[model samples]
Target: MSASSRDRKFPLAIEALALSEAAAPFSLRLGQGEALSLLSEDAQSLSLFCDVLAGFASPTCGKIFIDGQDITSEPPEHRAIVLVSPRDPVFGHLDVAANIALALRAKGAAAQLIDATVKKTLALVGLDAQNGHRADLLTPEQAARLKLARALAGAPSVLVLDGLLNELDLRAASKTRDLVTRLQRALGLTLIHAASSREDALWLGGRIALLDRHALIQCADAATLMERPSDARSASLFGEANLLTGRVLEIEDDVARIHLACGGVVEAMADAELAVDALCILCIRPDRMTPLFGALAAGDDETPPLVATIQSVLHTGEHIRFRLRLADGGEIEMRRPLLQPMRGVTQGALLQLAWQASQAVAFPMKDDL
Candidate 1:
């Protein structure tokens, strides 16, 4: 550990504990100095979750543990978790450095200690040169770093960022994210950042906790979450997924014979709970489907190739996307890297695609067949 790290408090761990019940009570565990990105479509939901974690709001019923101690009932200041949000109020009367000293002053910190800490933190967040600037005069990115520096000045065990990035422009948010991630690792600061998009969560590099409608859906690293999302809702949220309704025709080990509602029979990997005649939702990511320009592989006893009519092909410089229509008149999209050639394929052409049975997973649908 560096000298500064040794002088500061050791990094802390937090665990939001919940029983594995019907409500799926929203459990998350972060190791000491670990970072996590909490992603959700609902801004209010994210704020509420952060509120509960930071002790601004009490849970209806649950326990929140910090470093193995139950801190659910602790107030915001007592819990040692600091929350930084774009909506957090600033002191217009104070300059950048004084604004950061608010929390330090609140605790009756020594003037000398506060000065040294403020100088170090200002440099850490790259705001050292702007210590005298008025709060209102700072750019969006500078304002963001100011908030982070102030939060750090409080010496909180875990930092909760709620929709802070969404407050800035795209370029500014990207730069702020990179800077924060670097500061987080450098200081071994445990962080819980609420992200606005999948790209944001992935770029931040941490365990990702997904939420929808105020309910925590799934928690995993980016790759693991994308590969085996708990449900179709999660799969679609992580990336573009062609969700098709299907039924299990038969089962051979982990793979299932699926008869699609859109008029095709194929095989998909299934969990042990799936049985014959069960209604299922099959999710196929666009990039997972390969375009076959040569001889078609249409029929087989195992999983067969899928056929679609190319409605249009779009090249977005970075990648190629194909809009295809299925036999049942339903449409789906397929994306391929720019390196993949069209090979003379044109609009209204037959786009035969193949994929591994594992590439497309069929999740059990709640709807009765």
Candidate 2:
């Protein structure tokens, strides 16, 4: 089936492509310093290349295309692709100007234009005043910004950023990423930013493609990915929630009525013929479910209720998560808090949790079905 372009197109007419991976292991760090030295050392002069845009250890095996043209066999420079990674691609001994110039030179740019482009790009990153300083003498954040500037200096059609913002604190990372995204929009550049977290991807306003077990399983916009994920793995990667296996117990107003293994019943939006012998999993976001403070309220008189005990309450800035233990020994989390303290329920209080039938989902419970 042909996927919709609703995802691949942007206001600036740039076409961004995303791919998946297969059997990829999560890399646990052994020595932080050792890993840093290797990545930084390999990126000495800001010259970098990757054949496949987004893949795991099999760049050549993955198909790549730019502007709707297949460029899997083309050189990185010819493809107008620049990659800025975790290890800043700056020259330690060379000044920032020279570092930026090297990138332009790699693309066979004229020397005269290099100086002007370097100044402009550096200014965009708030580092124009430090163009004369050696890259090694600059602070970690400064070096990172310079590498991003150098990558943008060439005015590539596509920019790939990987792991550069993960090291920063939340505030700084948020600001820097916003700046990069603004630049991308202004320059009409297609940006493919890869990060290990969905929070980062959401901040960049970029679509997410989950890679698990070296396979491309799910790709969609931030809202779609979170709301209607293709499978359980994709759902977990987006953010852990309640994925409960259940059977259909009732259907109401185009909603599938599911009964969980723990004898709890809930309603989810579904089509016809999903009742008998239909084994499915229900997806509920932690923040969406709420603890049952009392018996059926007047407004949501028809909403299904799941009785649970408060296992824990987590204060998460904008909301408080009430981790609850459901009647069947399973766990369900509900989030509350839109200013002011929540009433009635203490940390260990028992309450009935209720949610709208439309908020939940029922799908096949298989991992690779």
Candidate 3:
């Protein structure tokens, strides 16, 4: 009935209807004007539930599909999927081994089957030594680890991890991601991970899909999506992007020279176009814009012409981020090795901004939809 539903008939990894949500007894209808007030309250609650279910809303009025198979009529049980909800509680009395067994048993698994799954999942979660410890007695980290193992023991074709990682500490989160990555690869599983953190989504390399107000807006591979989102919602969701308001002043070989409203001329490859009155936002990734070195004295190939001043440096374990201010007051982020000599690139001191022509990505930006 909706444009999105029709568009999805083509081909997709997953598809949903005009999925909506609201509080009970709200009595709202999209076709009726009387439901306008109720729409606001219902929309937020429905959106939250959809997010918790990894983009599945309750009482789906339309067909659903996965990998070209119609799964709308099937209950969650027959879908070869494992869904962990916020309401799902961990048993405080059971130990790690017992917890795994209990979950599989509840799914109607035989005793022998449950035992084997528990052992394999426990080993997967690095709980070989803590298998005997009571689940209540284990630390929060261990308990959380068990929860993942329980969900994974079934070896479901699809793993729908909602916000479980949000509750874990950095170390615990990193450990969980590593294990999930290994399992996903080993089992050839399709993972639909939902997170508010852009970094988390980016790290789970695959396709990145952006959902805005219950509608799937944009989806693309990690690198391509981050570097160039289809619109504003996607551009912002792809982590750090510089949204510059400008128009095409000139077009060169595969590049367009843009004149920013702030009176600065910048150049990026011309991927799309806009009329004289059509406003556009240029989405540029900070990492793509590296600090260019000056011209090499005698045939030095690495020196670049654009100059910049380092405003601050954020030291990450594997990478160091240098926040630089361009000569025109615009800022960009550059990531380099932690051990690299960036100490001398102090704040207010000038440095060159250089990047290959292929690194920059251009996207057509629109207002929030």
lDDT string, candidate 3, 1-369, tens digits: 654454333222234454554211111111110001101112344334334233344544444444345555676656655665454557878777887888677778898888888888888878889988888787666776777788788775556665566567889888877877786666656566665656666666666556556555565666666666666556655646666666666666767666655444566666665433345566566666655443422322332245567788888888888877766787767787766675456666767654454555444545452
Tell me each candidate's TM-score.
0.87, 0.76, 0.67
Model 2 over residues 34-121: C-alpha lDDT tens digits?
1111111122211222224422223414345454445556665566556777644578999988998886787687878887898788
Which parts of model 3 are misplaced by more than 4 Å? Answer: 1-13, 19-56, 59-62, 66-69, 73-79, 85-87, 196-198, 202-204, 226-228, 232-236, 252-254, 288-365
| Model 1, span 1-369: residue lDDT tens | 542333233244333433223334655567768898988877787788888888877665667766666678888878788999866866767899999988898889999999998999999999988999899888888988999999999877789998777668989987998898898889888999888778878876888988876677788898888898888878877765888888899888788879888766877788657778988988889899878765666577554556788899899998998899988899999999988876767887886766778898888886421
Q: Which stretch of 10 consecutive residues in model 3 shows the poorest summed lDDT? A: 31-40
Error of 1 at 23 (Å): 4.7
Among these predictions, the greatest TM-score belongs to 1
lDDT of 1 at 295: 60
Candidate 2, residue 343: Cα displacement in angstroms equals 5.2
Model 1 lowest lDDT segment of ten:
13-22
- Ranking of predictions according to lDDT: 1, 2, 3
Error of 2 at 243 (Å): 1.1
Look at candidate 1 and tell me the lDDT of residue 144: 89
Better of 1 and 2 by lDDT: 1
Candidates in order have lDDT scores of 0.80, 0.61, 0.59
